[model samples]
Target: MSVQRSWVIGAADCYNKNNVGLLIRKTACTLKPDVIISVDGDIIKIRSESTFKNHDTIFKLNEEFDEVTADGRKTKTTVTLDDGVLVQHQKWNGKESKINREAKDDQMVTTCIIGDIKAVRIFTKKN
Candidate 1:
């Protein structure tokens, strides 16, 4: 049998909320301001981050499209910041085009794979 291994990195936090006349509860979780890296037969990576204060452009490409069979609301297919550019493809019969300056630097981070998997290793360090 083959086992799959994955790694996720991100910022997390714990929070406590109290309602009036109610007991307080505490919860802990990781926030999205972090990055997630996954490895499979191939490799996939995901990154989530806050917006950058400075101005910058990011690229995106359309990946998938979903529509209601009855209404046909027609939603555009989009990929989130594939590179430094944003590309929007029309749904169904729409044309494929690119949009410049669609993503601000503050909105997202870059994500990509290194190369084919030859070996895998992991280590942890304390700060």
Candidate 2:
């Protein structure tokens, strides 16, 4: 069996609630940010592994979506697809900065596989 991997992008520790909200809003079709988080790009790897030296955008998972309260807590999170498939988060270890195979669901869900990540002051879509 092959292993799934995902790159760690902007975590809650790096970006504020507003920036995170923008990403979610851009991808959210009709669901509220409270119910869904969006992933962008193509899948070249699994969801449990990290795309080291890659440009893939990865979102850190947490127990809740409350930006005010859900800060710095490593917990089981869920992955949402554009088609409405909720890949529930299982478990992960944040101490070693390693990907946890236990956190990914068994179903195959296609989402954005981040490649290069650029850290800028303004986190928004420029036109």
Candidate 3:
């Protein structure tokens, strides 16, 4: 399938842990970033607002690619699509994080998990 779509920030939520046994502060709603996604065959390209640094990426499905994080950490990333969701994993410095994204009707939801932190970012289709 090949299609291109633009999404505007709708909302965000975060859940985190301060330490192994400590809960993070209350959910913080921050960083509303616009996004555009294009898919062609097994390749996908993503572009995000500058407010979200290091989010723009292009990769072929099921292949590991080199990527640097917004914080400047070099990581190996691999992306795959399962059912209707895009699942991404990034590994670096002996740690790993995951992001799951799904789009339906007019909205897209992304769930990100790292250590004890989890965040959900929502976006509405831009006309």
Best candidate, TM-score-wise? 3
lDDT for model 3, please. 0.75
lDDT (Cα, tens digit) per residue for candidate 2, span 1-127: 1123222322122222222365543332222111112334432222222222112224433322211112233544443332233333423344211111222333222222112322221111112
Against the reference, the lDDT scores of all candidates come to 0.27, 0.27, 0.75
Question: What is the TM-score of candidate 1?
Answer: 0.21
Runs in model 2 with CA error above 4 Å? 1-70, 82-125
lDDT by residue (1-127, candidate 1, tens digit) is 0111222222222222212122211211222233222233432222223232111112222345442211233445454333444233334444232222222222321222112211111211112
List clashing residue pairs in candidate 3.
none
> How well does candidate 2 score on lDDT at residue 123?
14
Tens-digit per-residue lDDT, 5-118, candidate 3: 888878877545422222213313445667888877877988777453437789998999998755456899998888878888999879999988888778888888888788
Error of 2 at 18 (Å): 16
Measured against the true structure, the TM-scores of the candidates, in listed sequence, are 0.21, 0.18, 0.79
Off by over 4 Å in 3: 1-4, 15-29, 51-55
